[model samples]
Target: MLARAINYAQNQRSYMENYLLDGRCSISNNAAERAVKSYVMVNFLFHDTVKGAKASAIVYTLAETAKANGLNIRLYLETVMTKMLDYKNEPDSILEELMPWSEAMQKSCGLNNGTI
Candidate 1:
């Protein structure tokens, strides 16, 4: 069963073959692969279940994006979790407050503060 599955996967080649059919499609997922390389390298970071792995990926994305945008990751997540409950039901107005580039979000998360 294992050998058959491996053979089938190699024959499928969908992971790389898609690049031939679509110019916009990536030739390689090197960026995404590199993004998870560190997490995967740390043995303790591996999750045994798909659900936990997905959850970890989501958290990692949030942290990385927050840090990249000059927001305090801890504060950004805390504010997002709390405000999501209040604004999630509202209209697009939440976008103004939740977006990392938005003035409101920057101010709220102290991204605009005179500190790195």
Candidate 2:
């Protein structure tokens, strides 16, 4: 059992190391994974207040969404919020502008490195 476990771990490590050869691959998903898991656990603490729970969930969603797209939350939110004012009357336009994978949003968030 011990030998099998060790072998499995070694296999996984070797697999992950190969990703380093790919220029865009990230060595670390730990931070991002932990952040998401932490939110899931933390949500239980705010379950008492419906309004607060909803608000917290939205913030968590926004934070995770921004992080997923290689965005700096503060900068992304600032830029998006400001730009959103111009398109408030046009919901569809605002939706396109706020998409994490959109070209304009990628540029605004400094994620123009050929990524989504």
Candidate 1, 53: how far from true, in Å?
1.1
Candidate 1 runs further than 4 Å off: 1-35, 43-45, 111-116
RMSD vs true structure, all candidates:
6.1, 8.5
TM-score of each: 0.59, 0.54
Candidate 1 Cα lDDT to native: 0.76
lDDT of 1 by residue, 60-107 (tens): 877776776789888888878888888867998655668666677677
lDDT tens digits, residue span 5-34, model 2 = 999988899686986888876788777677
Name the weakest run of 10 consecutive residues (lDDT summed) in model 1. Answer: 107-116
Counting clashing residue pairs in each candidate, in order, gives 0, 0
How many Å off is the CA of 90 in candidate 1? 2.7
